[model samples]
Target: MAKTQVEYAVEGIVTRQMIEIGKKEGIDPQWVQKRVSEGRIVVPLNINRPCSVVGIGMGLTTKINASIGTSTDIADIDAEVEKAIAAEEAGADTLMELSVGGDLNKIRKEVLAAVSLPVGNVPLYQAFCEAKQKYGDPNKLDQEMLFDLIERQCEDGMSFMAIHCGINLYTIERLEKQGYRYGGLVSKGGASMVAWMKKN
Candidate 1:
């Protein structure tokens, strides 16, 4: 529906943001665009927000992502924004605010304003929470609702998302062999994905 960074880069558009990312990564802007087009690098950016583009994935230095969010038990908006501030000050490459409590939209906006770095989120949290509030369980979450929530976040300037789609039936079975450890299949994102086979 929209021309993404990959589309622009593949078409030979070296954006100002790409230039900045190249400077930071000590590579040429054209190289950055090439990798972006080739799907070798990722620079999650939302045009709604003003943030320096950060290169991630293949051939870049290992980046640090500071997760700052509230659990179901706690939902303090100010505290989350403060964490974003702390993350930026401490040299976090990106920040994922996974607030499942309080006014999520307000918290996201304030947090985005609180830091110049890229802001990310786990949209499934909102979708699952909504399903729980209405349908009585996270398992009842509708896919349409999930997509709607993701669109809202994009509109609100979310630069990235932690969508763990790598887990497939084969991976699940393999992990189950090891008991899946910790939360096992009932983990954060795995529990929702009972179907579907992803690429390897």
Candidate 2:
């Protein structure tokens, strides 16, 4: 597979796989080619994954994402992997492993190994969980741990990452000015940060 979408576009040859996929979606082959050429659609292909599917993003059908993982109370890697497989078999565009309790890296690797679909993750969750486990304070987590986790996930062949980079100092100040209410910042990462800040 090509390293970047641009590389895939400049090849000037439409892979048979892309044509067949376009036909299945009732889209013209040229349209698919053009979209790929423009980098509007992304087909995340992992070198280790043999089964690849074209996921149309713009002006395409709504795709489904299934999240499967374990929490601290029930950290069952086997069960989580099974669910992820089922989700893919049932036609999920992507699968995300949000394992917080168990070995996060192990769970992610096993999931990636189990499914051919694009795997996504929220690095902050793993970072916060690890920080709490190690230092008993989430705010104690610095940029190094966060960036390291992000890089590790990327190196692990994650197709995409859901990074909450928007929730920074400015966003917090805005929230504070607006008066933070119970369950205000519903995002898990945002709530975790707020709690950590309050405690620290």
Candidate 3:
């Protein structure tokens, strides 16, 4: 298996990605490597996706992440690709393809191809959406299915993922005990996970 950036950093190897980010951030590559080894920095470039890299975390520039995706009512792949391009052109350091509608796999690949910015996604979005469509209830989302989807997305060259592994029974209990928040839970993936936890 190929080593991760963290693994390489721990071994004191200054990778090409670190050098590129160092050049871009106007910092020493060794400084970047030190921060990465200490887990204070991240360069989110997937080995499978050969894109321009960006370093995020302590001491680096505050990078902007632009989100583009297809909604249920507006699942236009071409439009989403255009949005990805526009985000890159407008100076976004990263991109999140959060599509929950209309051939999500294809949409992700197209967007990845459209921009050199590191691309990420919320795997739970696709898992919950597919479960809701297949079983008529997001609550019935299978654990194996979710894991498989995550692996597939990674294999498809998603540079990173916003996995909701933090949501569990304990979190649900805490939320229930705390009553209502200002906005409650506005996240679609978060709400789906809560609903699944509540039902199961």
By lDDT, the best candidate is: 3
> On lDDT, who's better, 1 or 2?
1
Error of 3 at 28 (Å): 1.3
* C-alpha local distance difference test of each model: 0.82, 0.77, 0.90
Colliding residue pairs in candidate 2: none
Q: Given candidate 1, what's the lDDT at residue 153? A: 91
- The residue pairs found clashing in candidate 3 are none
Q: Per-candidate TM vs. native? A: 0.86, 0.80, 0.96
| Tens-digit per-residue lDDT, 29-64, candidate 3 | 999999999999998877788887889999999999
Per-residue lDDT for 45 in model 2? 55
Question: How well is each residue in 1-200 modelled by candidate 1, as lDDT tens digits?
Answer: 66788898999999887898888988888988999899998888888887867889788889989999887789888899888998899999999888888878888889998998888888877877887888887767777888998989998899999785776677777876776377555646556555322211
What lDDT does model 3 reach? 0.90
RMSD of each: 3.7, 3.3, 1.1
Query: Which stretches of model 1 miss by more than 4 angstroms?
Result: 168-187, 195-200
Best by TM-score: 3
